[model samples]
Target: MPVTDVTTDHEALTMTLTAEFAASVDRLWKAFTDPAQLERFWGPPGWPATFPRFDFAVGGRADYYMTSPRGEKAGGSWEFLEIDEPRAFAVLDSFVDAGGAPADGLPTMRVVFAFEPTAAGSKLINTTYFTSAEALEQVVAMGAVEGSTMAFNQLDRVLAGLREYSAGKGTQTEILDDTHVRITRLVEGPRHLVWRAHQEPELMRQWLLGPDGWRMSVCEIDPAVGGRYRYEWEPLEGMPGEKFGFDGETLLWEAPRRAVTTEHMTGTDFPSTLNDLTLDEEDGATLITLVIEYPDKETRDMVLATGMTDGMEASYGRLEGVLERVG
Candidate 1:
């Protein structure tokens, strides 16, 4: 169920989720075909999808839009294909700008949802395709794995609610794949300067956000292939946070170019997630692409639910501040 076993190259971030459900394939088919059921769980929670008009057919389409908190709008259309009743349905999807204009950032995802009739009920599965590996990574960063996982998980919960009325219990679990989630600051400085600041444990403790009395104990790196590394964060008295450390071996380390580290986590059933750092020098500055690959789609979704992206933006902001002050 590892969702993040992906390439650090933004072009290689594509992955898929597959799970079985104790419901009939036909029952699951309606969940997707029926607009009433879809509107309930479509488009990750909080930002609801408004299905203004839809016509489900071979050449039919689903037009929808989302309204952001700041009142900005995003709209898109879903084109259906090979719509076999109660068994298989395929659709091509894309993100459109406000007022239904096609945008360049998103790849046209080809999604195939299949329903398998089982002895108990139906097993639902979906496979999504990307135009390019980089296209997949772009969406992943934009929260593709998280968003799709959230949408399906929500749908599962919704179906479970309906199953209760049918005198049955729902049984489904969304498992996530190996993942890592952390902020890599992209600053307006040379890669060497930025790397030195980040590799410095003392500088990290000075600017990193923590409740109170929170400090970084170690910031060690080998910075070469076959190198092992570890870092620890300890919360002092009244810090209001748990202390943790990443004690994983580095799988790839090509100095100032790319580094991949395996992360270990306890206190949860799940264990390790993989993380990668790709440092690309752009215009004398480095575009540090930091990626966390989860062990499963479920864990990845959980990380997304925590709004880690916003936290990342915040963390990177701190990294910038530290760089400015130190410079």
Candidate 2:
């Protein structure tokens, strides 16, 4: 939601985007420089990214690729041209081959990243200069705008995790059983604030959605036992019947500590599951745990085959950013 605007100037042969993040300049800068952190949120949803080699210095190069759910890979490279730590940087962005070499007959662009302090937090302005207006239009048509937006959203999650770890919290995940999985994180915030993020629709909208170009058009929650809720997501541009949602009923509710819900995926034959969440305070941090249980092993395997675990991890990563803002 902090990604404010994106614009293109045909005459100037440039495209720019401005976004406000609930993080410090240093925290945000690290998200770009840190290879591991960059890889986590560098690609669009359903596609995980990897940075095989990253050298964040003037004249250095970064070789990376994003892998789709079907194992298809799209490679890219960045040639760093400027490095002003914690403030601004510039690079030459280009398409690359599997061996980390620039692809032939592809256009390269100059990208400048400027970070400025703001009253709320920090503002990041990205300006990309292309060789021609046609080049800019080509990239836009290839979903560059949407991909960059999703990448920034992932950066929000990275910043949040960095803040929590800096505050002495640890995050971990475990596969408890064939039909069960649990994720635990030490959130750097109060229990009540964390609970509010789960209950409030406005806060949920900020991080609940998985990727860019997809929005929660409907969010309804009732924080009482037997209360029903529904969240519907609609793509920015898609077919008429492409919309999907989740509808569920709260089985148990206890303020700021625990909640239990049974959720079903709409428009699908997927089996519903009971989600149990617990929060405990320790040393001024909230130790949060979420456990999801499916009906049986076969159903669990079917769900796992759909890549639900990776999606949930991505969503939880974004939740870190939400927590930092609310805290």
Candidate 3:
């Protein structure tokens, strides 16, 4: 019900609706692009959709049908016109028959979905252009407005479920062994960009901070075996001059692929830890795996109890944004 407005222009034969969702741009993008997720909310309540063929790319086609409470089915198809990942897309939407042919006398509209990042989360603008005022009125009279509102409302619930799933997946901390803890995430962007973000001092400052209002003040890295690196952070406003820092020695370095280091945190009871990072690329995305080894199980448990996993997850979320900007 966060839909701000729904407007129709008779002269232009267009209808536009605006709504906002409490989800990140990337997550909403998945809701629209992923077939399984799309089906979960693409129809109004009590009228679920099933997509038999969905190809989410430029020039791709999608064939789907929605079922009514009485078991009647209405088929539709989408001819993708353009796509800009996590931003916008356009398609020709039309009614279809069971045999996969266009239904006679049904209006075909040009539809556009635009996504924008906002303070709350993301804003979605949906616009549909018809060939004539009659076509627009015809669809509107057929409950297009109410149906869309209900479908979007359903989307809100779907996004909420996705958030719950992501929080669990993103915050998962696995004990690989008595001395090792590992965390992994599939990041959006190429492997090289992810690697550079980890290696370069300037890029590190953008996302290395674990929480909001904290900034990295010092970041120095020598990317070579046996080289030394140091990073420091301080609160941006409160507790003037209070700081935390870490210095490390690189034991192994492989550009854009792997890194191994021994890290010692200053001003902490924790012991020095061995950190290993591995990056793998697949189809324009990267999977980053980070493993940290402690001296013993007690040290690992102690660090985990300090909410270190939550902080690391927060830092990883910021890194996703940095990758988008630099990738």
Which lDDT tens digits does candidate 3 get at residues 1-327? 657788999988899999998899998888888877677668764456778899888999999998653346899999999999989999999999889888998999999999999999999999999999889999999999878886786576457663343344675677756887867666678889999999988888998888677999999888777789988999997745578899988876667766778889976776789887766565576667677888999999988898987788788889999998896
Runs of candidate 2 with Cα error greater than 4 angstroms are: 162-327
**Backbone clashes in model 3:** 0
Point out the worst 10-residue segment of candidate 1 by lDDT.
Answer: 165-174
Ranking by TM-score: 2, 3, 1
Show where candidate 3 strays beyond 4 Å: 162-327
In order of listing, the candidates' clash counts read 29, 0, 0
Superior by lDDT: candidate 1 or candidate 2: 2
lDDT of 2 by residue, 46-132 (tens): 344778889888999988887652346899888999998889999999988877777876679999999999988899999999998
lDDT (10s digit) by residue, model 1, range 1-327: 212222223343335565566666766888788875676557653344668878999988898875432234677788997788988888888888766766776678787777777776666667677778777767777886676665565565446543242222111122323443433334555677666665566676665543335676766766554566677777776657777766666675445555566667534446676665544343455545455667677778776787555545555657767877877
Q: List the residue pairs that clash in candidate 2.
A: none
Q: lDDT, candidate 3, residue 142?
A: 92
Q: Top lDDT: which candidate number?
A: 3
TM-score of every candidate relative to the true structure? 0.46, 0.53, 0.50
Specify the highest-TM-score model's number: 2
Single out the weakest 10-residue window by summed lDDT for candidate 2.
162-171
